[model samples]
Target: MREMTIGKNDAGQRLDKFLQKALPSLPPSLMHKYVRLKRIKCNGKRCQTSDRLTEGDVLSLYINDEFFQPVKEEEAFRRITPRLHILYEDDHILLCDKRPGMVVHEDDQGTLDTLINHIKAYLYEKGEWDPDKEQSFTPALCNRIDRYTGGIVMAAKTAEGLRVLNEKIRLHQVQKFYLCLVHGTPSPRQAVIQDTLLKDSKQNQVRVVKKNTPGARTASMSYKVLQSRGKLSLVECELFTGRTHQIRVQLSHRGWPLVGDTKYGTMERNRPYGMTHQALYSYKLHFSQEGDWGELSYLRGKTFQVEDVPFLPFFYNQPKN
Candidate 1:
């Protein structure tokens, strides 16, 4: 028999769900049978499978030892060399400057060198995270940026931080600003682009459509041309809707495709710039003061920005007015 005490990260989850994560080797049927047989108890009393776990609750498991063995993948983070460009960090959250070409999570290609793994490794080294002590929670990213797009990404060190951050983002209480170099200067210089976006999953691309189709979603963003070079322009965009590739697709539809964007803009057009990946960066983030963020309340009305964008100086050096 073994007893596990619920911590803050492990609380607020159902017993069955927590069991699934804590004892992956335990068969579902057997787990249910154990609960029915009073083999699994909460605080020394019989507990239901659907019972929501609370902090300070103790779970007594009369199961076999084999079910407690950790999986190999749980130790993968320890093998990785932590490479992080952290912008800000607190007890609850961390902000990182992800460089272009680094993936936030593992893709279909089965790459191990990912941003989250590096973060996990960093936390493990600092004694902030221990997989053995955790049942269902791990340090997780609150937001994701494209693999080829450099930007600021937020990570949550605690489960409450993740929940609050996700809620704020869903309510549009968190504002994101992006910087991109486009092929041509926008005629109006500043305007909000509103359109429907349809994503083609097979092609891994999105297109701006005239109307809402079956799978299309409304996309909106306001952009301002900050500087203009010979044939290229530096643009700052603020997203009102978080659609996939909304800025890229909408800007391309407006004849201002991002520089080095081979999918939306011609490769021949990008050849002059010698950039294979799109010149886009999520440079700034702001947390709106209006929302109640619970533990993350201290972050309200705060703005964090990345000062140095790799593509900025090159475009800003151009002589064109």
Candidate 2:
């Protein structure tokens, strides 16, 4: 028989989970079969798969020694070192300043050019995540920005961190702010706008629709001008609801299309820079919580911000409002 002791990181996890991590080569089918046959035990007593493990617990296995041999993890994936700019990092989460045109998740082409994989690779090098030691608990992103937008995105380093932050986001306790450059000055500069937006998945576009329009969802956001020059205005936007291309579609529908927006913007107006994508940035994030957040409680009442990209220098030089 073979024996192993649980550590802090492995504590509080399920018996099956710890076993999977400890014995990566053991297939789930065989692992369950062994457990059923009393081939696995904790402290010399048969244990259930759902039993939670604790530090110092001595687990023993009567299974064959061959099941202990796991596959070589490093051979599975080559490490990647993308041009990642880190803004804030703690034991629980990592906040990165993502560059423009980088997709957060892969597209239809199955491209791996995503921020999540980049983050994973970074952690792997630091020995934070290892397939040799971990079965399925990989670091994940808590929030995502569009491919063309540049700004702060949160990455959860642990499963507990993911759960806490996602709860805060679900309850609207997490506030996200963006900086966007639009073509015209919106009337009533500061106001929350609500409209129905219908998305065309086939074309990857969304349009503002009438009330009760079928397949349309309600979208709401508040915006105010920070600076303006001639026809271009720098706007600060806060989203109350998230939808596909919500900010881009909503602002464009109001006649103030984004500076570099090719879809809903004008070609004649985009001539100056020969730009292809809209100039939008997710610049800041504010967190507030009253109750338990587990590992993320430290984030409560804190704000993380990133400076405006080439936009501030690029837009500030324009004639002032």
Candidate 3:
């Protein structure tokens, strides 16, 4: 059983329609049957097919046990050609430029290589990784870049380093910057986007909500247009509140989808460039840890810039076809 509160976007919408959006994996037939059997309730009252939803309505749903399963995170990292850029590294942390077409971790068996695997291999080769002894140290990435998107990726060598970095990220103390190429230039050149996002598991899509939306989480980001090239524009993005697909969804919502982002932007818009995957790079990161910027051993007072990709090295490796 699960409970959700309706918001402004869901008001006046049919109960069935609202349910479909809230629970993407549940079948319409199953929902209908549950509603017919009075297993589903709105505001503690049985809802019918014609029941219209309203803001602040409380919904309760009964789902089967199949939906609940224990998740096992993969730990094995495969060895791939080290095609990454080593921007900075120390005893406690690693700052590397992740390349495109490399996954951070593997999901299935006998599959493609991942960044974690390669990193593990590198550490082992350097006598940095040893599991047999208690003193053996392994590297763990605190943040990730999309498999198709390349940029600065962070990793921690010690457990304390991981804990500190993860905490700093959670507290928004770590500043992350990204360079991206978009289809069109935003009018304001600089602005902030605040919205709600709901992921459709079945379609593997995210629905951006301009107003209040049920089951949606608030996400926000700040962006500035830095340069323009023909129909494309270079933009720098700073994440205010990190949410899944926040940058992609917000840019797409503003009608300036990232270049080469086939899922969000128009294919015709990318035809001239013959590109795939948005040209985005996590170029810089700055933060003060333990309230002492100078005392921090790892990447303090440091910046990473990839000099290869022209304006943005992570994306658009070669000009359009």
Candidate 4:
């Protein structure tokens, strides 16, 4: 038998729904059976799964220990020394500042110490995650920035937070903005760049291709000049459609490749700062959705911006305000 108390954040939800979150590994049929068999109780009394829980409610589950076992074949990554620069955090979500050179997720590099691994270790140390107790739930990053682009990345602490964050991203409710330093001056000061981009998987690079070209996808972004000094110009770009390397390829095709982006940009301007990665940063994220966003409704109409850009001063005579 295990006793659990309902906290204020989880008080208003129904019993079954709360159980689904609390015991993620337990099957729904088994949960319903526990309620039907009176093995689950609230406030020292038998409670139905439909019962609405209030704050200070005491819940007891009289069950076997098999439910607490770790998931088979779902191995948890071992804890590492966490190195995260957290910008904001709440009960359900966390906003972290990712620096350059950190991989967002596991890929061809086999379990290289990544931001996700750091987040898991941090959460585990803080008691926000339980590998032995949780069946399938793992705290994960909701949004991914490229390995070398430093900026804000969203993370979810709970299952509901993760679900809602993904939903908002899918619907394009979460608006993103990036800042980059280009080598040459772009005409008209402000305009939208539209082009079709093709990705070369073998080379890990993207290029602008003709409209009728095979495997080409439409990519577009709007940019406004933030500041210009000498041969460099700082521009702010907002993506109309999210594509892999969309901003880099489209902007580079217009003859203003980002500084230190040797993949597309010329390496002539890559000096002075000895920069290894691009000077592009995902700087702002605005949450302006129309409808309800479930657990993240409080984020609507809000904008989060990060200002810890490492290469801003090197490109411009005066830093961008």
* Per-residue lDDT over 1-321 for candidate 3, one digit per residue giving the tens place of the 0 to 100 score: 877777543566678876675555667889899999888899888889679877788888777745322234454543345545677777667788887777787654545477777777677667766543321134678998777777778887655567567777887778888888888778799988788898786676787865667778888889998877667788899987767666887898889898888888888887777676777777777774445433254555555665555345433343442
Q: What TM-score would every model get versus the actual structure?
A: 0.93, 0.80, 0.68, 0.76
RMSD of each: 2.0, 3.8, 14.8, 5.9
Clashes of each: 0, 0, 3, 0
Better structure of 2 and 3 per lDDT: 2
- Model 1 residue pairs with clashes: none
lDDT of 3 at 271: 79
Comparing 1 with 4 on TM-score, the higher-scoring candidate is 1
In model 3, state the lDDT of residue 109: 56
RMSD of 4: 5.9
Across residues 45-128, which tens digit of lDDT does each residue of candidate 1 receive? 999999999999999999889988865564567789899999999999999999999999988898889999999999999999
lDDT of each: 0.91, 0.83, 0.72, 0.82
The residue-by-residue lDDT of candidate 2 on 1-321, one tens digit each, is 988887655677899887787788899999898888889989888889999988789888999989778766533224566557899998888999999988887678776768888888788888887755654466888888888888999988876778688888888888999999898898888989999999999999999889999999999899998878867899999988878888999999988999888888889888885667888989999997676777777888999998647577778778776
Task: Write out the backbone clash pairs for model 2.
Answer: none
**For residue 114, what is the lDDT in candidate 4?**
88
lDDT of 2: 0.83
Q: What tens digits encode model 4's per-residue C-alpha lDDT throughout 148-170?
A: 98888999888778878888888
